[model samples]
Target: MLYGAMKVSVGAGLKVVFRPRVEGREHVPARGPAILASNHLSFSDSFFLPAVLDRKVTFIAKAEYFTSPGVKGRLTAAFFRGVGQLPVDRSGARGAGEAAVRSGLEVLERGELFGIYPEGTRSPDGRLYRGRPGGLARVALASGAPVIPVAMIGTDEVQPPGKLVPKVLRPGIRFGEPLDFARYRGMEGDRFILRSVTDQVMYAIMRLSGQEYVDVYATVAKRQLAEEARARKRKSAQE
Candidate 1:
């Protein structure tokens, strides 16, 4: 199968090239359904995380990655599929959240590993932003799976936002102790409980990543930066 072959080939190739140092992998459950909740830094976060793991970690990706047209798009789609990523429509926030949770639940029900980013989007400034919950709480609660906090250090520098090729930099992957939310089992509908659970996960990630914590969402931070850039450009033009 393409998945098996690529997993071995890609994993071997990356080990030789990036020489990633993975720590705390012992925390990942060798078998059974578990949530790998991590801080997103670069596009390579998905690839690097799964590459290091012995088990196949499936993550929900944007549908555009699968639905793009033409030869290049097909290759991209195939590559994502080969690497065990599921495509979900990320259009409306509410709808997309629901769809992703549903897909994740299905994966968990099958007793497989599911990966998610608690921060919703990559940190634009490398500071760990406030987690969006983004149904991560709901999924973990619903699936009754232990949440493993993972940190992908130095990935942003190796393959930054706009870069396609990665530099031969050693990134570290650390997995923290698994967090159990058994007490909040039946309270998935509680927004306050969700926020609390998500914050706890983010805190664990912060400790592992050693990145400065920002109180705002990454998307909001990016928007603010864009607006500030526009304002500066306008002021310069007027001057």
Candidate 2:
């Protein structure tokens, strides 16, 4: 009920104001379980993709969004739930990854579309980072669903991090053809197969988004950048 209402109200407002350019929407299956694997560029990537899709796409959000206290917290949690977001505790990396896979499989079993960011986190920079093989690959192989590569173009420019208001510029969404990994269906337990499947999906996203490919994980890139900044600060202090 709330999902339909929000889709009509918020989705309509977004289309009117931003006028997002969407393409290849036909690539999405009309009624079946499929994975929408996308490159994570901005916070708004989650909102814009679901708004434009006719079918509901369920994504995992951090548990804090659902567990915070106070009136504002409750309202925020309600909003996220209304939009079909499931909360997962992300404090432990291994546990979180396993939980996410479980959540995704459950959604797929219901014959619903499950949306995921293969990169695990948003790109610290605009470049495409390597996909984590554990969650996305496991769910794809386990559920045997077609993986659709989605590109959210110019979303970083429209709503960069820490920006209160988005710029009134057009963002684009391109859906690539669905990829099937049926040959590797029963090999989800194999680490090598997992990495191979994940790399294939990342390659498709890179082609669609036209972002520079970074072979490292986004979290590693973020840590390296932070270390560089601290090193510069230390050098300046010593000078």
Q: What TM-score fits each model?
A: 0.98, 0.97
Candidate 2 scores a C-alpha RMSD against the true structure in Å of: 1.1
True lDDT of residue 66, candidate 1: 97
Give, for candidate 1, the lowest lDDT window spanning 10 residues.
Answer: 132-141
For candidate 1, the per-residue lDDT at 143 reads: 83
Local lDDT at 207 for model 2:
92
Give lDDT per model, in order.
Answer: 0.93, 0.94
lDDT tens string, model 1, 1-239?
Answer: 88888899888788889989999999999899999999999999998999998999999999999999999999999999888999999889889999999999999999999999988999998999999876799998888899999999999999999999889999999999999998898788989999999999999999999999999999999999999999999999999
On the 0 to 100 scale, the lDDT of residue 172 in model 1 is 93
Clashes of 2: 0
Clashes found in each candidate (C-alpha, N, C closer than 3 A):
0, 0
Please write out the lDDT profile of model 2 over residues 1-239, one tens digit for every residue: 98888888878888899999999999999998999999999989988998898899999999999999999999999999888899999999999999999999999999999999999998988999999999999999999999999999999999997787999999999999999998999899999999999999999999998999999999999999999999999999999
